[model samples]
Target: MTPTPVDIPTLLEISPQGGIEGRSRRYEKFLGDMDGVYRDEHAWQDAVGERGTDDLVYWVDDHRYQEGPGALIVGTSTLLPGRYGEEFAVTRGHLHAVADRAELYYCLSGRGVMLLETLDGQTSAIELTPGQAVDVPGHWIHRSVNVGDEPFVTLFCYAADAGQDYGVIAEAGGMKNLVIADGDGWALAPNPDHTGYRAD
Candidate 1:
């Protein structure tokens, strides 16, 4: 059966950038009750390329957190249910040139590696597992790839102010340059920095 949409409250709690700050406070009020959102089967699989990867079966859309003339562009977690050792694509994550919004990811179950590429041609990898959360700050181009031994699931919380100058998402698809950067320079893109931001 097709997956149904999720509620606002549930979306907020499970998302990486969601939930009330302070782990201790979150436990006192939530007790890790992310409702029905599980980490192992909730993080959506990103679709890369023309044919696209039909991995993420569930999505929450650009609502829930999208507020303001409103730049609060938010979407809930997605689900990818493939066994580990198999490579998978998450989403073709994007951000506008001026939008300083932050992307948050919260892991509910399973463990996986994330591949992140910045707009300036930097790359890195991150190890993720259950009950862990990671933040993808603003002004950087990024994407999430599932490199794990088991199915990976997690929640995503997109936060942005609608009025920002660059609040749009730009996909790298069809961009021959591969990597875009300041003024007059281009280079063949390398693996993205998933663990941290670019040094330059």
Candidate 2:
């Protein structure tokens, strides 16, 4: 049998402050893009009024050489510190489009939380500081929450074919819990608006 051809290996310069020197793509999310992301509609609207829709909230830089199932996508997520009422800043969050795809997230700088949940109501929230990481298994819907005063930066890798189903969270009225301020620290509060997730 013939050996399969392999793709050329590439060197990546990853920044703890959030970037990939050889990144092939960059995606940014602004305050205006987070219309229904936050549970506090009133506070979100107030923030939009004060900060304007152009305010940068978070951005991602990723590198991918191939789109095949066996390929991998590596990236950095930078979430700027922010608050909408008592809630901290967060990624829009998603489950993999393929459902069974997994992901890994390693903290590069600042502090944050990896909020994970299943369709049947199981949930987990892991706090991460510089050098910490989370291995998110398949079937989990995940989101990143910035709980520090500075930007939360994380290095992430996942299957190239995972894609993303961001609408799952929106359709469920946000995740099951919210990462919010707790004195000078952070804590999780039940998201009153969550209506549970649906696989469909």
The best candidate by TM-score is 2
What is the model-wide C-alpha lDDT for candidate 1? 0.40
* Cα lDDT of model 2 by residue, 1-200, tens digit: 65333356789999999999988899999999999999988999999999999999999999988788798999999999999999999999999998899999999999999999999899999999998999999999999999999999999999999999999999998999999999999888999999989854
What is the Cα-based lDDT of residue 21 in candidate 2?
98
Model 2: clashing residue pairs? none
| Model 1 vs. true fold: TM | 0.46
* Candidate 1 lDDT by residue in tens digits, 71-171: 44444344343321122434334453444666776676555544455556545556567877788676555544444434455665564452232112222
Estimate the TM-score for candidate 2: 0.95
Clashes of each: 30, 0
Full-model lDDT for every candidate: 0.40, 0.93
Cα error, residue 26 of model 1, in Å, equals: 25
The C-alpha stretches of model 2 lying farther than 4 A from their native spots are 1-6
